[model samples]
Target chain A: MDQILTNALGELLTPMTAAYALAAIGLAMHFGFTGLLNFGQAAYMLVGAYAFAMSTLAGLGLIPAILISFAASIVLSFILGIPTLRLRSDYLAIVTIAAAEIMRFIVSTTGLNDVTGGPQGLSGFARDFYAINPFPAGEYGFWAWTMDEKGLWVRVVAWSLVIIAALFVAKMIRSPWGRVIKGIREDEDAVRSLGKNVYSYKMQSLIIGGMLGTLAGIVFVLPRAVQPGNFGTGLTFFIWTILLLGGAATVLGPIIGSMIFWVLLSLTDGLLSAGVDSGVITFITQNQIGGIRFMLVGLGLMLLVIFRPQGIFGNKKELYFNG
Target chain B: MANEIAKGKAEPGCAKVDPILVADNVVRQFGGLTAVDVKHVEIPRGQITALIGPNGAGKTTFFNLLTGFDKPNSGNWVFNGKELAGVPSFKVARLGMVRTFQLTKALSLLTVMENMRLGYQNQKGENPLAAMFRSVWKKQEQVITETANELLVRFKLDAKKDDFAASLSGGQRKLLEMARALMTKPTMIMLDEPMAGVNPALTQSLLDHIKDLKKEGMTVLFVEHDMHMVRHISDWVIVMAEGKIVAEGPPKEVMKNPAVIDAYLGAHHDSDLGSKKKAGK
Candidate 1:
């Protein structure tokens, strides 16, 4: 019981939670603020992770690897945006989803097995990052809530990135450019008539959001092995759920949403697994707990959609998902 | 150039003053149907010129063509002596011509003041790098805000400056659209039905605002069906029927012309005089 409680509480501060929060904030910029339907956010993460890992493996330093990753995300955004930005929002969504799938497939293919490690994935890229960690080697935390030096370092870096990204995005949305993006979301024709280059704004939005997703991807792989399977369509859907759960347009919504999502997920998993072990819920085996947890979250999301579709942080009047 | 000389002759298609917009052989067709087939037309500078036509006379379509909102099938137009063939709407606006929509396109999600700020040209805050640092565009933003507030006060929208554009009444939206357009400090303002859907109480104020544009040394071109409003404010009137210009002159003279009467009243000669008297009043 103590182990279950500790794990559930600890999940809130994990690097994975921070990564999802960052990615979801990026999605909020794309869908909530700009009215751009970018269904391939996972592709940005994949590209970022692979680019960072590959560059690092090829003898590039940490800063260079991170820069290359951001550049890769920008190139990916251009490829996706150039053809689809001029069309309806749905075209971007379609192209993005397909592009993400293609990227995952490419990384997982046998042709790139030597470099990407195929389905097996890549590791040992975080040694330099871990070497620079200022945290001393020890389990740090009060009472039952403890994290190792590596875990503490990853969490600090990841959460810092999330906070910085959120602040940056908040400032942007309040700026003159942010006004144009929100305007485009409402009506591109009106923005264009006002002498704003709508295509250029949309492209800029795509690239910025993609770059943030890449940053999230870098943090996501820092504490774990880089794997193509981790950045599937399910990952994108999870990010969307986090974004919608908090508040699609609000700065802090994604962070709060991610924390809640992970906590709920772990809590349910722990409870269900314990219930099965105790023979209190004999109908389902322990293996089914993962599926059941997802089902429970889905049900909660449905309730949220029905009751408050604008999300916890978003204003009801500002809810514009039509694009 | 032939049309310039034709102006003094009181010909059907002519401009009596210095022309700002010149359209030649401009045609826009929707499948087999010709929406606008203007052969030649010139709009005078620094005057409130009203483009009046009966329903389905292609007045709005002509406005769309000249403003670069829609392409003409076969036509070339010049604004301020510069050829504007294949220019995009934003570029057209940048080149000193801006337009408002028939159905107000005020961004509903944005605040009234934010909508006004959107009209200011060449905002440094719009640049990605410049946007990150507040100090870079902060002064310009303040200048834009002051300008926006001033316009809002002039348009009587200062009280609702913080309100969402969606929350405004229909007439208020129209006023906001016009005020927002002025933020660009445009040379030519093309309004598409500025009085449409507006309450009668606000109609006179809108008319005064239209007249003010001309007084400010900015050319004003508008499409309106209300003959009374057209005659009350417009210095020049251009009449269109069946996708072609049928008459052009001073409002009082053009309103009484037989071709203009026939196009509007549909061959009813007796009712023409009666409607003309009512329009002239």
Candidate 2:
């Protein structure tokens, strides 16, 4: 039990967890604040990843490449948001999913094999980003858990970016502009009559949320080589699940949700696999572990929704009827 | 009828005021239904005016058109002489004309204080760049909090200051909406069904607050169905039915006018049978 707990704690502290948390935070803004059903958060992530990787591949420096990627994500958000965000809520969900899938297809196409590396993806592109690491090489952790120099660096940068983005979101929600967005979420007609451009505000919210999703993508591939398969619909669903697990419309919700999600996933996987191998449970094979773990997670989510639709720490009042 | 009122001696109380908003032959059509067809309606500056009509009388529709919430098919409306027939809602608010919805549109997710903060104009922290200097905005927030506190106290909503707007009762929500509309510091305040769904106990205070709007030199245009309240606080009354203005004059005269009576009492005679039986008691 102690070993399993230590192993889970080590995984929890990884940079990948931070990146996932950031992406989930962005989704929280889109779905929670604006009541936008964006099911293609992974597409935004793909664009961010591809943009950063491609820019670096094209010989751009680290910081410039990252900034360029962020910009690219914003442009993509507009493109994805324009036709869909103007229409019904379901349209946004449909279009976002299609957009994400389209991005995945484009990134994996043979026509762009030279730059995107087709399905193989880009490697050594994150080296420039990692080059500025201030952390010295040493195992850092207490007890049975420790992360090396590179792992430590990734965690530091990833969590730092997440914190900064989360803080910005919190402040923006407090501002007048934030109020207008929330108003649109509840009733666009009321806000429109107040002389606000409803479409423009929705577009802005989508773009901002998408850009955050993109930031998550960049953070994700920072710890490892960029891979096309990573940015999938399943990834988007996982982010949504994380967002739901934590309270949506909360700054700390996504961060906490992502951590809990990954921890649970790892915990369930470890316990089930250990049980199967040690003969404590004989019905499941090692090959079936992945699917079973997700099923368990899904059941947990179902129960959560049944009892507490506002997530673990969410205010129920925030869960009003979406206009 | 309007011409007759104009020919008569202008009432000494609020008749001599200048007109600040004019709806000239405004028309809104939804397929075969004509919601509002107001013609030659003028809102006197610094006076509380009531727009009374029966259910489906098009009072709200007219309010929507005036505030730029809904576009008129044909007509012209000018606020302070500026043509506002096609302006958007937020821009209208920014132009010193703010309105409240019949069903209070308070952001349910936000705390009452936060909703009040959103109502305030001239907040420099709305810019994405200004987020770093949140301290600067903090002072502005303090002013906003103080102002919100004062307004909340006036409305008797100070106790629920930290609660979510969703947690408020229907009457409290109405008060919050009115308070929010004031945040924009608009010269003209248009309220849609301000008295509807409000408590009878709160009605007098709400009416007094509305009268205070006129005292403070803010033009008020409200659509109401409560005839008693309408006659009491309204400086002038404009009656609408099936889209057109049937009568416009001082409350006493407008209430007695045949057209205005027909629009409310005559048209709803059958529907009022149920209520009249109860009222007879």
Measured by TM-score, the strongest candidate is 1
- TM-score for predicted model 2 compared with the true structure: 0.89
Candidate 2 residues A52-87, lDDT tens each?
A: 988988889987887998888888888888888768
Contacts from the true interface found in each model, as a fraction, amount to 0.73, 0.44
Residue pairs clashing, model 1:
none
lDDT tens readout by residue for model 1, A5-104: 8888888899999999999989989998999999999999998899999888888999999999999999999999999999999999999999999999
Compared with the true structure, what per-residue lDDT tens digits does model 2 show for residues B1-281? 33433434533212324678866778889998888776677677777878877889888888877777778899987888798878877788878898999888877767788777777776766555564466868898789889989898988999999988888888888999898778778899999989889999989899888988888889898888888998899878877777777777888887778777777767555565556554421
lDDT, candidate 1, residue B74? 92
How far in Å is the alpha carbon of A38 misplaced in model 1?
0.4
What's candidate 2's i-RMS value? 2.8
Which of the CAPRI classes, incorrect, acceptable, medium or high, describes model 1? medium
